[model samples]
Target: MSAATLAAADSATMLRRYLLRMRRYPSLTVLLVGMPVLLLLLFVHVFGGTLGAGLPGGALPGADGRGRYLDFVTPALVVAAAIGAAQGTAISVAMDRTTGIVARFRTMAISPVSVLAGHVLGSVVQSVLAMGVLLVAAVALGYRPGAGFAGWVALAGFLVLLSLALTWLCLALGLLSDSVETASNLPMPLLLLPFLGSGFVPVESMPAGLRWFAAHQPATPVIETVRGLLDGRADAGTAATAVAWCAVLALAGWAWSLRLFRRTTTG
Candidate 1:
């Protein structure tokens, strides 16, 4: 068989393996898919309700209502939905690596390339499900899209891209980690940056210096870009900035994950 034919066969085989694994543990599906929706409810029903309306302006230039915590929280929820899965995916994937499942899979027709990507495919699916649940919950909680249908579509696309980028990063981390625990913990610092961004609170509300950093952070641009799309008022700068952030992270994470995978596999 030619190398191309062999490669195609390997990919198909790997995808089958992935589906079988997913079927065996449906709750992994629940955990990956349900957690984001739960967080959205927690924030909107509880925190957003009180805090959103209480904000100084009642609503800012981009958001629907500073008072409508649902609107305020939904944009952040999108980001949270994207990033939240990274930690869980990392820990789970790391366990697969440490236990020699990855090695075993590597020896099969499945290539190392397929092994890592298979895990990321799962994450991408989970992210989309989480987003759907969150979207319904947000709307139910009185979160209306001020931007309209096109805006909603853009927002959805952004979340998907963000999820892809993050899933790859987590995969890399999972590969490089000393253990599953480290893989899980490594993403927290990056995760927290979103909070400082326009997610839960406006960057302007944050302390001046911290605001500067927060405003410039990856999450900041993502949140802004997402919020703008959701509200139908996305700024070009914010959208461009968010796209740039995703690009940088995606490239870095993909290269690093591959390198780490090689080192781990060889060593």
Candidate 2:
């Protein structure tokens, strides 16, 4: 087989390996799905009514405060679910490193790219699965989205791009960490980005300094784009900005990860 074909075969095998690992050890998947569901329930049931009443325009017409809040917050929760999956990717990568598995692979005839590719593909699948479950939970809680078929398509594309970007970044973080604990903790800040931005509340409602920061941050545009797409009123500018951010992050993470992986494996 050609080098490309060999690499593809190797990557497929590695992907299967990662997926089986996930199935055999289901705690990570459970945590990834459960945390977002719990947060969704807590926000919509406990705090939704009060918070929804405070939205700039108040609740939607014919909708109660809790329902309104559920609609508003579901996109952010989906983003949070993606972030949680990325955290799992980092931990998985770190485990491979510390367990001497990666070192063992280096001595074999496998394609070097296959290892990282497996993690990226596996994590993206996990992220999408978690987001799907979260969305179902949101719908069950009376979160009604205004998205039509096209809007749903756009939303899925954007989510896949976001997950791909985040997965690569976490892959780099995993390769960078000296220990699994550190890898697990390094991505924690990403989980907070949605909350700190326009995830839980409107950016305009924040203090001046915080509001400016929130509006300018990457997460805000991302969340806003998701919100807009779901409402079938996506802004061209916000979508462009979000796509640009994803492109930059994906490229940076891919370069950083490849460099680190080569250095660690070959040196």
Candidate 3:
């Protein structure tokens, strides 16, 4: 069989299965669309002043302290949609395992690859919805964007890449985790890593050890690239670094998650 034909068959199967999952549970679809807006509001109104002070605007001098804090945080929160959206896959997978949905999928004739791809696609849909909602809110809050339409598109593209990449890691962990509770905790490290990184503050403000980690960490690259794009800075930015890290995570998690997923069902 030709490799091209095999790839085409696999893509078809993946899309079919993903659409089926959407039909099976529409409530999850709602949650995915809603959560990012919730997070954005919670940050902007409740924590906006405090958090805004930290962004381009706020109380900070030299920086666009006069800028809207919501604008600064919008990208990070958009990136954060990945965490929520990706976790949906983990939670759903764990539930599927407990209820025997995965076992049923295992018994099917189509390649098991659909199981992974469906979850990723579902998560991306959720992330996109959440980001869109948050963007509207950002604009309402007087957040004038520095980037034009192209820059905005770039921002969205980055989030999608990062979202899909980290999702596999979450999938691997969800498969290995014994319960839904445990799977939820898996994202905390990834989420907090950004805070420790340059996402919220400059790396220089942190301790030497932390500064070193934040300087080289994945989230830093991702956030810096995001900030640059969102603010429309001419800098080459951190997307290159983010792409490198995403590739590493995607490769590592795909291999590791597959091993763990197979074990969970077989054992």
Candidate 4:
């Protein structure tokens, strides 16, 4: 077989292994999937109406405060769910490293890239699945986005890119850690980023320093772009910016992860 074919085969095998392991556990995935749904429920039913009422008039067209709030918050929760899934990546990667699976792979004929690719693929898959469950729960809760077919396509593309970027970052963090606990904790800040961004509220609603930070952070542009797309007000510049951020992050994380993986497996 050609080199490309061999790599593909190895990656597929690794991917199946990762998926089967996840299926056996189920609990971690359940927690990863459920947290976002619970948060969505709490935010929409419990706090959404009040928060929506507090928004300036005309925040969203043709919708009441609660409805508008749901529209705004759903994407954030989706992103949050994706990030939450990264915690699983970090933990899984750390477990593999600590348990000597990675070392064993190094002594075998398996493709090196496949080792990382499998985990990254699994993480992204799980994240997307979690996002889907979150979306279903959101729709059941009366969260109606204004996006049409093309818009939904754009949203899916955006989500996939974001998941890839975040998953890689988590993997790198996992590889960098000395323990599974450390790896799991390293990505905890990601969960807090949505709150800091324009996720739950508009950037303008924050204090001056916070508002500036909120507007410029990676999450803001992505969230804004998602919000615009869903609300039928897509902006090309914002979309480009979001893509740029995801690309840069994915590249950085991929490079960092390779370095750490090599260091750990060979040393």
Candidate 5:
């Protein structure tokens, strides 16, 4: 077989390995999916009424505050779910590195790209599954979106891109960590980006400085794009900005991970 075929086969094998790991040790997957669902319930049931009232247009006609807030916050929670999964990816990568599995792989004829690509693909799948659960929870909790089939397709595409970007970055963080605990901690800051951005509330509601920061931050555009796509009113400019941010992040993380992987494994 050719080198490319070997790499593809190796990557698939690695992906299956991680997937089986996820099936066997399901607690982490539960936590990753559960956290966002819990948050969705809390925000929509507990805080939705008051928060919905504060939205620019107020509650939708004939709908209660909780319902209105559900529609608005679901997108943000979806993004949060994706962000939360990155921590899991980082920890898994770090575990493989520290457990000597990665070192063993280094001695074999396995393709180097296959190792990292496997982690990336596995994490992306995990993240997408988590997002699906979150969305289902949102719909059950009175969250109604205006998006049609095309809008759903666009939303899925954007999410996959965003997931790829985040997964790559977390993979790099995992490689850079000296310990699994450190790897777990490094991705924690990413979870805060949504809260700091236009996730929970509109940027206009924030203070002047924070509003400026929130508008400019990468997460805000991403959140907005998701929100807009769900509402079927996505701005071309915002979508472009979100795509650009994802591209830059993915490239940076891919380069960083490859560099770190090469140095650590070969040196």
Candidate 6:
């Protein structure tokens, strides 16, 4: 087989291995997927009304108070789900390192790239599944949008890009950790990013310093683009910015993760 073919086969095998691990430990799966769902319920039912009523001018232009809030909140929950899965990715990678899985794989005929690719792919798959759960919960909680077929497609495309970038970054962080505990803690701040951005409320609602930071951060454009798409008010400028952020993140994460994987295996 050619080099590319061999790598492909090995990656598939490793992907299956990670998937099996997920299946064997259903509790971890539930916890990872359920946390965001619970957050969605709490935010929409408990806090949506007050928060929506407090929006700068009023509720979203065409939406009722709680209804408009849910539209804004659902996309953020998707982002939170992706960030939360980063913790899982870190733990799984760190565990494999500590338990000598890395060494074992090195001693085998597996392609080195396959090792990292497998974990990245598995985590992305898990992130997508978790997003599905959150979206379903959002719908059940009365979340509705005006997006048509193209808008829905765009939403899913952006989400997959976001998940892939975040998962790769987590994988790199996991490879850098000496222990699973440290790995678990390293990615915690990613979970809080949505709150700091234009997730739950408008960036303008924030204080001056925070507003500046929130408006400039990576999550804001993505969240705003998602909100706009769903509201049938998608702006080309914001969409371009969101795509640029994802591209930069994905490239940076991939480079860093590849280097870390090489260092971890060879050093």
Candidate 4 lDDT, tens digit per residue, 1-267? Answer: 988898899999999988998899999999999999999978877877778877777643333666767877998999999999988999999999899888899989978999999999999889999999998988887888889999999999999999999999999999998899999899999998899998998888899999999888899888888888888788899889999999999999999999988888778
1-267 in candidate 2: lDDT tens per residue?
A: 999999999999999999999899999899998999999989988898889888888664323888888888999999999999999999999999999999999999999999999999999999999999999998887777888999999999999999999999999999999999999999999988998899999998999999988998899999999999988999999999999999898999999999999998987
Judge candidate 2 at residue 16 and give its lDDT: 100
TM-score per model over all chains: 0.89, 0.97, 0.83, 0.96, 0.97, 0.95
Query: If the candidates were sorted by their lDDT against the true structure, best first, what order would they fall in?
Result: 2, 5, 4, 6, 1, 3
C-alpha local distance difference test of each model: 0.76, 0.92, 0.73, 0.89, 0.92, 0.87
Q: Write the per-residue lDDT of candidate 1 for residues 73-111, one digit (tens) a residue.
A: 787877887787766678778888879887786676545
Which run of 10 residues does model 1 get worst, by summed lDDT? 58-67
Q: Point out where model 6 deviates above 4 Å.
A: 57-64
Name the better of 2 and 3 by TM-score: 2
Off by over 4 Å in 5: 60-63
Clashing pairs in 6: none
The TM-score that candidate 3 achieves is: 0.83
Q: Clashing residue pairs in candidate 2, if any?
A: none
- lDDT value, candidate 5, whole model: 0.92
State which candidate, 1 or 6, has the greater lDDT. 6
lDDT of 1 at 170: 82
Segments in model 2 whose C-alpha atoms lie over 4 Å from true places:
59-63
User: Per-residue lDDT of 1-267 in model 6, one digit per residue for the tens?
Assistant: 999999999999999999999999878788999999999878877888778778766764333677767877998888889888867998899999999999999999878999988888898889989988888888887877789999989888988898888888898889989999999999988887899999998898889999999989998898888788777789999999989998898899899999998888888
RMSD of each: 3.2, 1.7, 3.4, 2.2, 1.6, 2.1
lDDT of 5 at 264: 85
How does candidate 5 fare on TM-score? 0.97
